[model samples]
Target chain A: MLIDQIKTIINGENVSIALFFIGMYGLCARRNILKTIISMSILQASLVLYFLSLSFHPLNVPPIGADLNAYAYVADPVPQALMITAVVVGISVTAVSLTMFVSMFHKYGTTNWNKVKKKRGEIE
Target chain B: MRRRVLAVLMCIVCFVVIIASNKVPTSDDLPIATYITKNAFAETGASNAVTATYLFYRYYDTLFEALMLLFSIIAVIYMSIHEGDKYDE
Candidate 1:
């Protein structure tokens, strides 16, 4: 009974909502800037999941290859396509943020946001 | 104290909103799904609707995404150069 109930309740959008809250918690609670950046990536992933889940169907086929036998439907292509771009952008953003973090760490010798903020304040 | 409590409150608020909104889609897919599924083939000539959508419909965005990856990689390489000042490992 419990498993069936849980299965009914648990789906893509719901899971994404949960992940979004987890990412939000990470963003709000983490002291390390690196963790904060990772939280942002988590947030992006949750958004992607949310969009993909919007058109989710059990009997739906993939949006690939137009020619196919009788199928109920294909999932929305727009969300999948956009989410691909989102993933790419998210990777680049994470990469750029990491590089920036390394530079900051080297200069300041700390990765904690409070310490970095204090140090930056002292300097400028 | 305040931050932790606020975080918990935010979590509670988020859960409440989601439960209250009840906006999750459960029935048939939206109109865009049907339109794209049917017409994507005729319009793009690409078999894969997703490929057609990204590669044909919005190639510019894909190009920029590629550029962003390239620039970010270059920046990482350039910034991580050995500076002869040893710090923490």
Candidate 2:
């Protein structure tokens, strides 16, 4: 029953929203840019999951070919399409964020957000 | 103190709005997964809907995404090496 309830909760929009909040919390609370980037990646994963779930139809088969009558379930293509873009974009964003983090680390010799802020303040 | 109170109030308002909007629908309310079944062959020649979705419909987007990843890596490398030179000098 709990599993069913959990599934039900996940089926709706709550999963994505939860992911967003969790990611935001991680990004906001964590002083390390790497951790923040990881959190953001989790957020992106949640979006991917949400979109993929949206495309699911009960008893659907892999959508392909002329034999539509043979299968009871047909997979949703839209989410699949969207997710491809999402996955790619996610990787790109992660890469960019990570690169920025590395640059910041090199410039300041630290990964702590507070320390970086202080260093910048000193420079100013 | 005022700013902290204001932030808390904003947080409360956001929480209330989110909770109010969090309505879950039953299975019957869900959209019919017909698009993949109908357009699988035309859009993506593959039989697997997942594959078609990634390869055919969003191939260009995927490529650009990969490029973005590459660009980021290059940027990181460039920055690190550039900074290393400053220390060496």
Candidate 3:
């Protein structure tokens, strides 16, 4: 019961943070270049989630009502707005990274990090 | 052995994150947020406070974001074009 209450009290940020670490692990531990790119996108998504979560409250309306005073609770709009740009940038970055990976796969003939390094004469 | 070590380290990092995130108060109570919510409709003539903030207060950031996307698109095109050329040869 105590643990459940604590879970209820835990901030939404905890979920985002966990996602971040999952992404980080994938980025560090994965060998495939595509998987690494996927991990990077996952990290970006977690950041977006964190920002969106920052704007939430238990019973808040969307910040779109004409009668501003009618609503006792409204979510923070700044984080929501900021995250829109972040999401766009994340998409752009992922697209570009994937394109680069395609180029690299063509050049090196392999997606595995160690194999690519060996083929390219890079020290691991 | 290396994976076990990394897993332990990751667990420690996750614990630190939980502790740090727990300390941050989870409430929408900032004074600036209050001001934005109250006056955004009047200042920007938009019912949506988030839209007003992005389109008016921080429009420059949005402009740069667009430019960044544009450049990335150009880069991808150029990179793929060279690959095509190499294939023809």
Give one digit per residue, the lDDT tens place, for model 1 in A9-52: 88888888889998998888779898899899999999999999
Report the TM-score of candidate 1, chain A only. Answer: 0.90
Error of 1 at B50 (Å): 1.1
The stretch of ten residues in a row with the least summed lDDT in candidate 1 chain B is: B80-89
lDDT of 1 by residue, B38-84 (tens): 77788878888888878987789788889888988988877777667
Model 3 misplaced regions, further than 4 Å: A9-11, B4-8, B24-28, B83-89
Instruction: Compute DockQ for each candidate against the true complex.
Output: 0.56, 0.37, 0.64
TM-score of chain B of each: 0.67, 0.58, 0.69
Q: Arrange candidates, best lDDT first.
A: 1, 3, 2
The true-versus-predicted C-alpha distance at residue B28 of model 2, in Å, is 7.8
Ranking by TM-score: 3, 1, 2
TM-score of model 2 vs. true structure: 0.70
Docking level of model 3 = medium
Better model by DockQ: candidate 2 vs candidate 3: 3
All candidates: TM-score: 0.84, 0.70, 0.88
lDDT of each: 0.83, 0.68, 0.82
Query: Which model is ahead, 1 or 3, in terms of TM-score?
Result: 3
Candidate 3, residue B48: CA error in Å?
Answer: 1.6
TM-score of chain A of each: 0.90, 0.81, 0.91
